[model samples]
Target: AQSVTQLDSQVPVFEEAPVELRCNYSSSVSVYLFWYVQYPNQGLQLLLKYLSGSTLVESINGFEAEFNKSQTSFHLRKPSVHISDTAEYFCAVKQSGGSYIPTFGRGTSLIVHP
Candidate 1:
């Protein structure tokens, strides 16, 4: 089955702090990487993706991730975080045929303390 695993279930940080979300995947074939962020009860928004070119990808919102083929991982990072960054982050992967829907991880909740 198509699957993605998020190592951390939750991450807590202070305002203006830094945060990272770990992600890993397993697939028989090639795949695309994606990071989506869910704010509170809201739906997810695409943070970044690694489709074809470079292994590195970044979102407009100051988050970035690197696709590592050897490790089969795509981990997200932010030098500093804000309270507004508090939300649920999900790591997803899609297959090459475009026949596979994105498989999301269990999600990691980021809590920002004031």
Candidate 2:
């Protein structure tokens, strides 16, 4: 079994500033993770994921996440955040070949200020 934890429930940041949403997981087996972003009044969207390739993965919108096996973390980072980036971020984990469903975190709300 696997579980995901998002350290911060809410992160307030100014526009164009660097931001990071910390995520950690616990599992006895190898697993893959995903970062999802949910904008207001919208469904959750896939921001980035770390499966089997390089430890680091990036999204088209400039967000990136690094899967650290030692730390069991997959923190999401953005060099410069925008107002549009304000949303709820969720971290999910699924054990390799375990289940089709993934365990999800409580979610972290990113509020970008101008």
Candidate 3:
């Protein structure tokens, strides 16, 4: 079994500033980690994922997350931000085998101000 935890419900940041969205998870079995972003009312989009090798993963949009097995954490960070970066971020964990259902966090809303 696996569970996800989003440390912050909301994160406020200014445009061009760096930001981090914290996520932690627990599972008895090996799992895959993922980060998803939702823009306003739109659907969730796959941002990045850690499937096998290399604990570090990045998205095309400049967001990156490191999977820490010791701490059971996958924290998302962006060196710089834009107003368009505003969205709700979700952290997820899925059992490595068998089923594909993933446990998602409550979501952390990132509000970028000008």
Error of 2 at 39 (Å): 0.4
lDDT of 1 by residue, 1-114 (tens): 568999999999888878888999998889998999999778999989898999989888789999998999999999888888999999999897576788999999989899
Model 2 stretches with alpha carbons more than 4 Å out: none
The TM-score of predicted model 1 comes to 0.94
Superposed model 3: Cα runs more than 4 Å off:
none
The Cα RMSD in angstroms, rounded to one decimal, for candidate 1 relative to the true structure is 1.1
Candidate 3 clash pair list: none
Lowest-sum lDDT 10-residue window in model 2: 94-103
Tell me the TM-score of each prediction against the true structure: 0.94, 0.97, 0.97
In order, how many clashes per candidate? 1, 0, 0
Residue lDDT tens for model 3, 1-114:
789999999999999999999999999999999999999789999999999899999999999999999999999999999999999999999999666899999999999999
**Which whole-number lDDT from 0 to 100 does residue 63 have in model 1?**
93
